[model samples]
Target chain A: MTSYVSDMRRRRLLAGGAAVAGLAACGLWATAARAQASLAMPQPDSAEADRIAAEFTGGAEPLAEGLALDLPALGDNPAAVPVRVHVTEPMTEASWCEEIILIADLNPKPLACRFRFTAATGSADVAVRLRLIQSMPIRAYARMNDGRLLAVRQEITVAAGGCGL
Target chain B: MARPPRIWISNETPAPGEVVRVRAQVVHVMESGFRVDAEGQPIPEDLLTGFTAMLDDALLMEWLPETAISQNPYIEFTFAARHSGRLRMVWSDGSGVADEAEREIRVG
Candidate 1:
């Protein structure tokens, strides 16, 4: 009887181990499938950024200058990363910065925020907090009242990820 | 009704034409809806969707924020002090709930 009990216990353990291994393999396969889907999606690239910009500017190529974006090279806390954007152009009624658009490349929602300004605004400078999902480039696009687009980009590495599953 | 928010200004009193920084923050969960609870249930999205600053009657700056913003959202911006008036700020969430606070500033 004792020998039979021991044999049954061993069989149960082996069956449990096999089940665990099968579950792990299933998990890996699911992960790989998700990764493949992500690859098929729009990636964080300048072309994607351009497409977003064109959506706002009607196919106008944003000038890669005239916007100063301040962000830390390494983000220790991805939850609340401070960001500052300053438009170089003057804030006048005739030639003022109309809006400022922020984009987080790796975020599920690439368009972070859009800040609108009027002539009454003293300056085209803004400071805000952002959440990053991974290490990627953050871009700022400033639109002038004259329909000109100015942009700047910066890359940041997040020690801890945020805004991601 | 949402709770009142906290607002801070770098300088309450500034010389005419001087630039002053204004910062405002609110207490909120800012749940992104992408996270799951301990029970594995998905959390619903709740975020501050809009922020607007006004001096007297003129609009100073307005922001359309997103889920990328962290919890207890905070924003700062600078504007030239042109005259003495009240600076009013409002933050609105996706549910249409809004909280507002104002600060009295003087421009000499």
Candidate 2:
């Protein structure tokens, strides 16, 4: 009879340990899910892109000159639309382009890419391919080493049946 | 093993202080992880996350790209050559896998 009682107690202890392990596993899964959710891309919106740019520029309006954003006015293929960004200003140690950011207003994730440059680069010219969901405006924001912000925007119309299908 | 990427430069023999164009392309599906497979499984996002160009150990430029970039990514940029050296291009994916290509350029 004593052995039976001891067996019951051991079984109960084992079940309790298993429950704790199960709870830990659940907690880990929840943490992973939250992390993934935070990384999920937000929907496309030009206003959202503007907000991001404003934040980057410290709530200041970026000058729309000295920077050129090149893209086809009519994009034949949205899946691989070509974009080129250039800052006409000279890149010297005292005044150089610090970073260039590309934003596609209609893409599910508007922030496409960012290129960082140092005085060693000598110039701020970058070309890249992006995915566009529809007809929308694309913007390029450039930050100079001297803390000046410059931006340029271009509108492109894409035909039906592009990326994000 | 993945295939080696293709890299192209517009001016292999550029004069000193001249700006040379560099272009690179890599073949990859660039899965965005937003799609569901036929078996109801979420497709994991895989993308080229970083690119850098170095000239004889001197960093020239670096790019941090996002998933919005298209498949078989193509990138182009220009840098002024001050001297003759080996220009190395490296591209890395989200999985920490990196592929590199190099070109020798002569400058006066």
Candidate 3:
């Protein structure tokens, strides 16, 4: 009888070990799948970003506007930059205001931030804290509901250096 | 028992469908893992590593943090307000102790 009881206990242990191994394999498979998805979604290359801009502007050349983008020219701390971008436009549903996008052209992810608002906001004022991988041109694209894309750019100098590869 | 940490939101009042800024500062001793005592013994890593915000009962945001986060970590996120509700914020440390605080925001 004692031999039978010992055999039963050993069987239970073996089953539990098999269950744990199965769970670990499942977890690893899930992680690998996610990594592959990210790898497949290639980062937007410079040419692609430029194409997006050109198509956005409807053949009109992108020119720098006098819009104010508040970021320290020389960021002492690269961790955070309090950025504010204000466009000189009447905030009306039909009056050419649509969405504001913040782009860090040199950051690993060039598309840094985006904002969409209704006419209730009353002002095309956007404020947010953003991360700067390094010194680069921070581009702001204001896409109007009418499909006209306005452009603006500002260069910020980092005290230490730009966040680089 | 220690003092209950205080938290407040600093930004535009929340309204339905409006993206409002939220900032919080909690006062607590966050010990980094690399610290050494006077006798040069390695201090165990005990720091706040996670945070979550719930609007009434639904979770709005959850954060899994890293050691790179500076001491007395600060987090900022924008959430679209759906209705008038209470914002409950909870923080936890590596030692498994948790602290929670709540604030009310009116969203029309």
Candidate 4:
């Protein structure tokens, strides 16, 4: 009878130890996952977004609907995404365009590319290839000759595996 | 008194009225000489820093590169062709080494 009682106690202690070890393993896994997520800049912060906005707008608040930026529907290759920006307004001498800038909202550095146009260029069709860290909002801002700032944004879903990761 | 370099040009046959794509790659070690050798002595720097390509007496491209370039430098450019002639490639290094090579092309 005494041996039976001792065996029951030993079994209970073993179960308790196993439970503690499993909990510890789970905790360790969670901590490691959090560390990895922190190391990745999968999203842009408010300050970075503001800096990108100010680069072309010169601190003036940009009107968010005048320019149109087109991005890929699905980007399986995160290394390069084909982007094109088209301005509907007529480009003329008096209607000259100043500059166009591309911003990747989720990239570690949001400022991607910039192009300054002259009055001689009558069309605002700019084609370029860019690297996307992940799926994020892409923005295009146009500075007009009249000194007005126009901006547009589009969201794209980027698949896993990209450059600079 | 080194071996004569060999230069090859792609796009031997170009269109009648098209920009001729020219790609030239040469074999040479562009040593900066700043790094120390395994024996703890400063190695002398030797590298090609300047290169010029001409087509029938017309300068097509000229470049000034730093020592950070790879051992073999590859250059690409465009030349508007009028007729067939010899393309000359000339290069010089900081170590006082100079070399030249040539290739012929037919411009349709």
Candidate 5:
């Protein structure tokens, strides 16, 4: 049978689509047409992580401080690597982390997951496992309730690639 | 049916103004949908879509899990110790199947 989605197109769509899929629900576009729209998004290049984060910050650059992302200097496993994102700023009614986005630049699907927080969460400190595809920089952006955004990036070296697939 | 999950808080009983760490984990395939079977056909996506931590009626945190999350996903976070209540960790899949684990948090 002839292929409807070419292999290269399928690969590119899978890369960009899954990333957008994670954001789709939050973006409020889960309809059937949204799937096609996300798949039609531009192909991810080397700067994929930055572009994804921009969607959340609304072009406002995140500060380098008040946030820290913890991952190993070297991740031996591409399948389940540990990660921790902590908002250094105090969490109070006046200020707290509103949302968090984790991006693995080298992965086929760059946007891994997003976390939404409230004052009840205390410090906005979270830890989870992620699949890393290659030895590259992992970026995290945190949206604060005080109209400020914080971000941190760490160079995580994984042994092999393709774990995200 | 699946087995229950594990939830651990560093200090369940803490004085007011104290913060405690929480760790929770569950079992799931977390299928990425990128893998193909013997016929080289893509596998349909099936994975937990959301995880939540709640204390009584208050929502502490929520995580949206994607295919990049590992099998048998695990997560950890921290919360302030306030009034005593039941702390619950809930995990839900795309089909709206919600599974949860709970613990009594006695804040002094």
Candidate 6:
């Protein structure tokens, strides 16, 4: 009878240990998931370029081609980097480029500038000077009148003091 | 004090059914508010936030600039060329400071 009682107590203790270990494993998994979620958020010195594009495109994923992003691969000065964008397609009253959104992935604010055009804005080609904070990929999203989001990306290296200001 | 804006057109007088490029520049520091002074004080933002180009009576294009634009911003765009009466450009800042210029566009 005493052996039977001792065996019961040992079994209970073993079960309790097993429960504790399972709880520990659950805790580990929860912590790991939280860490991964945090990592998935925007990284430092980076912008969620895709997310911004989607917002502008009314939640439609942008087509990754069709825009001509003209800029220097290496920028000797971040203060004034020349950038030009040309939409190769024809512009018409029925269909035209409505706007162009310029995004600097590493800038404090990703949406750098927006150029709005109409059918009378012939060619849909525009150029401007940009101020980049660092070396990073930049994107130009063109929103067409027909509800298409056209995108192009370019990577640039700043050669001097960062243009943070 | 803000300086006057300067504007140039690739061709003021173009043949019918032609496209002309328009270049506009406004002189300003385009000071971004994110900077810190030598004493680690935040600088105030001063920028030309809006630019509009009009060909005669129609709006050709508009540019919305932010802190990421360089000082003395140079913007270039294109418009359908004709014997437009005028090409007008207006540059404005956030706090109501504005400057504008107009050029007569005549076809031969």
| Residue range A1-165, candidate 5, lDDT tens digits | 347468768887877787667765455444544211111121246477777888888999889998899998778787889999988877986678889988887776778888998877777888888886567788899998878989898888888634545
Q: Where does the lowest 10-residue lDDT sum fall in candidate 4 chain B?
A: B61-70
Task: Give the per-residue lDDT of model 1 (tens digit) for B1-108.
Answer: 856687778899999877788878888777776666545666677788999889999998999988778788888888878889999988888777578888998987
- Fnat of all models, as shown: 0.60, 0.60, 0.00, 0.00, 0.66, 0.68
**Model 1 Cα lDDT, one tens digit per residue, A5-57:** 99999998777776677866545445343311111122456566666767876
Two-way DockQ contest, 1 vs 3, winner: 1
- How would you encode candidate 4's per-residue C-alpha lDDT over B12-83 as one tens digit per residue? 776643446555566666544544544556556666667666767765555554432345555444444556
| lDDT by residue (tens digit), candidate 2, B1-108 | 767888888889999889888989888777777766545667688878999999998888999888779888888988888889999988888777568899998996
Q: What DockQ, on C-alphas, does every prediction get? A: 0.33, 0.28, 0.03, 0.04, 0.33, 0.26
Local error of candidate 3 at residue B28 (angstroms): 18
True-structure Cα RMSD, model 1? 7.4
Error of 5 at B98 (Å): 4.1
Q: Count the backbone clashes (under 3 Å) in each candidate.
A: 0, 0, 1, 0, 0, 0
With a 3 Å backbone cut-off (N, CA, C), the pairs that clash in candidate 5 are none
The list of candidate 2 runs beyond 4 A from truth reads A1-44, B1-3
Error of 5 at A79 (Å): 0.6
Tens-digit per-residue lDDT, A106-142, candidate 2: 6667788999988778889999988777788889999
Two-way lDDT contest, 4 vs 6, winner:
6
Docking class of 6: acceptable
What is the docking quality class of candidate 2? acceptable
- Candidate 5, B1-108: lDDT as tens digits: 756787788988888868889988888878777666545566677788999888899998999987668888888888887778999888999878557888998988
Better by TM-score, candidate 3 or 1: 1
Question: How large is the interface RMSD of each prediction?
Answer: 5.8, 6.0, 12.5, 12.7, 7.0, 9.0
Cα error of candidate 2 at position A14, Å: 61
